[model samples]
Target: MAKIKEKLGRWLRVAIGGPMGIIAWGISGASAMAIVVWGLQTVALPLLMLKTASWGIWGLGVFRESRAKRENPPPKV
Candidate 1:
């Protein structure tokens, strides 16, 4: 049980952290593009899509967490 819990915790952390890291990277990339390119029109759609994907990844993590909680519920105090 302890090992299972440890593995689950690591998985959850990765699931949540992956999207967050991607989102942060995307934000920085977009900012750099905006500053360097002098306009966002060219890369706007792609950047938007990247950000959207990050959100989707995050939603998946949330869904997984909720499902896990529903399946395993916390122990009583």
Candidate 2:
């Protein structure tokens, strides 16, 4: 019957569409989270490495200065 077919079609649409919509939304959200995480790491990792390298260079400079001063003492009066 026409009425029975219409009812069945509507039920099938709802049954498939509801879960498909939810799955699509979840996939979009997960992809967004992954992109955000990747972007943050891309920017932050370089800055952290630069800061550590600067600290290391500064420490080496200080060590060299101290050693130089010890090896060549100032002239006494």
Candidate 3:
């Protein structure tokens, strides 16, 4: 249970915490590009893709934490 919490905390910290600036920047830039040019999907698309990938990395790291313990459960008496 504790491990799960730790993993959750770590994931939230990373996913929602870290890279926020980059995501925000991307969002703003993409929004600007979108507003300025309604047909430029390439630029905005990459930023959105980056945001998705960064979150994926963060989530994957956190999710892996639980598996680490589960795969190597401590010895029982």
Of the candidates numbered 1 and 2, which has the greater lDDT value?
1
Write model 3 residue lDDT over 1-77, tens digit each, in one string: 97679667765644443454345545556556664776556557765675676556555655565555568765563
- Candidate 3 backbone collisions, by pair: none
Query: Of 2 and 3, which scores higher on TM-score?
Result: 2
Model 2 per-residue lDDT tens digits across residues 30-65: 545655777756656554554455445445545554
| Candidate 1 runs further than 4 Å off | 1-39
Q: What's the C-alpha lDDT at position 22 in model 3?
A: 46
Worst 10 residues of 3 by lDDT: 13-22
Each model's TM-score?
A: 0.48, 0.45, 0.36
**RMSD values, in order shown:** 6.3, 33.2, 7.0
**What lDDT would each prediction earn against the true structure?**
0.64, 0.53, 0.58
Ranking by TM-score: 1, 2, 3
Tell me the tens digit of each residue's lDDT in model 1 across 1-53.
98689769856655664445456556656656665786677667776776677
